[model samples]
Target: MLDSGAVAEPFEREWFMRHPMRVAHDLVGAMLVVDRNGDQVVARIVEVEAYGGMEDLASHATMYRVGRETIGSAPGVLYMQRSYGLHTMTNIVAHE
Candidate 1:
């Protein structure tokens, strides 16, 4: 766990522009800090799923219109997905 005063340096826009697999590697075992309203939440990264783009059959880009737009857009696009018939996971689009 991070100390209450721990400060994280935000990554540059170029960082997310890399291929999704590389980003996934960088995310493993890293720290993620999120601040919403007045609450701050910190979590450790374990796993990630990467999508390359239209060529990636499993990517949203090949499934729907919005998928093409969002997945092809900049790196920080957010979308929703129902995983394993269990829960909906919020997804952030990252691609080169």
Candidate 2:
């Protein structure tokens, strides 16, 4: 039998602590705009991937800590990085 009032495990606490945005709750439908040197671009954010901080290989967290390195142009904000040295890709974040 298990104790009903047992405290959450470390990993469980960490998981719960993660501030993830639900795809359906936050971004089922939304628009995104990008402007570079007077070039205006626009599109809707249809998909996203959440990297749970530094541990995630697909996240900037591993590369550097928040508010420290110039992580990239989109620090802390979710965005896609190009892959295979090919064409541009797309992504989004739950940053406010």
Candidate 3:
């Protein structure tokens, strides 16, 4: 059971519109919420990695240019891709 007053305010799009490094840093200690079948699950974000476009050699954008539409789009959008053709990697798009 949860109290209505215990709920935290949601992060806005502007909250994720900063530099990837900054966003990653700020994401620490944040809470991630998942609602499934009327059940809500909450998890704390402990760490995050920032990936800049073009310049970041490790960034998927370097190899997958087609993803720019979502990765370079507005903030708060989910950027997902398959890694090593096995695991699905999910990320939040940061600043342009």
Candidate 4:
């Protein structure tokens, strides 16, 4: 899950600290897996949030200490953190 073409986002650790509104609706193509007793559940990601990586201080991207240009260049990065025993997540859009 951390490899493949999908590398870990420098922002991966930040999204969890932000406020969450509605994620389940946005996560369509993204994989959603859960263990219910002995059963496993999974789904795709469809929707997500925007973490202005270069500008947002509370972003995992900020932790990298990369130059503004480098940070801004990153795209398709995803961040997820579980809170209160709940999962919180978001993504970074590609720069066009």
Candidate 5:
């Protein structure tokens, strides 16, 4: 059992090597940790959407050249793109 205020161990890279659908489902409630310039930021992952490459028609990989490159690249690469010309959406390449 974990004590209150204790943070869980970070997930390993292998955790993301699984199929995207599994990754998305498992990510719910996980904590996202960001360390920048010695400052740490942590947030709870509340939602996620999985996009299967090539086989998924709704995936951005099917519609954009950038998406294809990003998805095809190695895992952990951040695929950052503008959403609907407004919000910036960030995704991580998975299943490499």
Candidate 6:
């Protein structure tokens, strides 16, 4: 479990209820704070990516059944992906 007790604020919750493109744009410069094993880890969100819905051919939600369901989950849910089995990427859900 995260030691920081990560919880969404009202403003952040509002942001998550919008379209992915909007959320992606607004997320730039945002801080991602996580408490890893009692150590605070912080990172700035310099880059953000927004994928079209399940119909988009390039979207994971379109290629995998699990991704489809995951993208549709409640806002603020964290989604993670592995890149070429080397790098780990993270995403947050935004639904209108």
User: What is every candidate's alpha-carbon RMSD to the true fold?
Assistant: 2.5, 14.6, 3.1, 11.5, 3.1, 5.3
Ranking by lDDT: 5, 6, 3, 1, 4, 2
Q: Estimate each model's TM-score.
A: 0.73, 0.43, 0.74, 0.29, 0.80, 0.78
- What tens digits encode model 6's per-residue C-alpha lDDT throughout 1-96? 344676654355666888888989999877787888899877778898888777778877886665787987888888787766798888788879
Off by over 4 Å in 2: 1-18, 23-25, 35-39, 58-60, 63-80, 90-96
Candidate 6 vs. true structure, TM-score: 0.78
Q: What C-alpha lDDT, on a 0 to 100 scale, does residue 20 get in candidate 5?
A: 86
Compose the digit string of candidate 1's lDDT tens values, residues 1-96: 567696678766678877789887887876766789989787776777787788989976697776777776677665776665798655666777
Q: List the residue pairs that clash in candidate 5.
A: none
Q: Runs in model 1 with CA error above 4 Å?
A: 3-5, 64-66
C-alpha positional error of residue 91 in candidate 2 after TM-score superposition, expressed in Å: 5.7
The candidate that achieves the highest TM-score relative to the unseen native structure = 5
Higher-lDDT candidate among 3 and 4? 3
Error of 1 at 46 (Å): 0.9
Q: Which residue pairs in candidate 3 have backbone atoms (N, alpha carbon, C) closer than 3 angstroms, thus clashing?
A: none
Window of ten residues with lowest summed lDDT in model 3: 65-74
* Cα-based lDDT for every prediction: 0.74, 0.45, 0.78, 0.46, 0.79, 0.78
Model 3: how far residue 84 lies from native, Å: 2.9
lDDT of each residue in 18-48, candidate 5, tens digit only: 8888888988887767899999877777778
